[model samples]
Target: MLFEDEKTNSEIAKMLHIGETTFYKWKNNPKFIKAQHEYAVYQFDSALPLAVKTLIEILKYGKSDKVRLQAAQIIFKRAGLFSDNGNPELDKAKQRKAIA
Candidate 1:
């Protein structure tokens, strides 16, 4: 509830019938932090397939060329083929091609 809930800490605390200080203590606890991290990972994992599908749909069917390009860039960046610092794998591939 602490994670998936959109309510503020105070509001959630009120709903949970706990004091604000207690809520803060729980929120700051190591176990709570770990649980939050795991929950977030699960949520992201569950959404990943749909997220990829949406990105593909956008890349293929976006109304504007700019939007389609942005989606393609996102896909490439996530796949490690595009990066601001340049990809070493890509450089290695180019070097191999040069040798060939």
Candidate 2:
């Protein structure tokens, strides 16, 4: 139930014909938590191949320069290749200085 769908605690409890407190108790069980984390990691890892493929397509054939730049930025940031996703006020200051 947890791995297959992204359901809220309440929804999952209702689906299982249980109360929310009982659901939380089961959710917080150590084995259940471990399994949950493992399942989430598996899901994330499984998606990476498709994500990389789409990112490559965007870099190569995106219609707009803005989108291609965004794709390149994603690749660079993931590679620790430096990006300025920094303080907005600092960015504005830099922009003003450039204009001046």
Which candidate gets the maximum TM-score versus the true structure?
1
Please list the residue runs of candidate 2 whose C-alpha ends up more than 4 Å from where it truly belongs after superposition. 4-21, 85-100
TM-score of each: 0.73, 0.66
lDDT of 1 by residue, 1-100 (tens): 7666788999999999999999999999999999999999999999999999999999899997667777877888888887756487965664455445
| Pairs of residues at least 3 apart in sequence or in different chains that clash in candidate 2 | none
Instruction: Name the regions of candidate 1 deviating beyond 4 angstroms.
Output: 86-100
What would the TM-score be for candidate 2 when compared with the true structure? 0.66
Q: Relative to the unseen true structure, what is the C-alpha lDDT of residue 80 in candidate 2, on a scale of 0 to 100?
A: 93
Where does the lowest 10-residue lDDT sum fall in candidate 1? Answer: 91-100
Span of ten consecutive residues with least summed lDDT in model 2 = 91-100
Reference-based lDDT, residue 12, model 2: 91
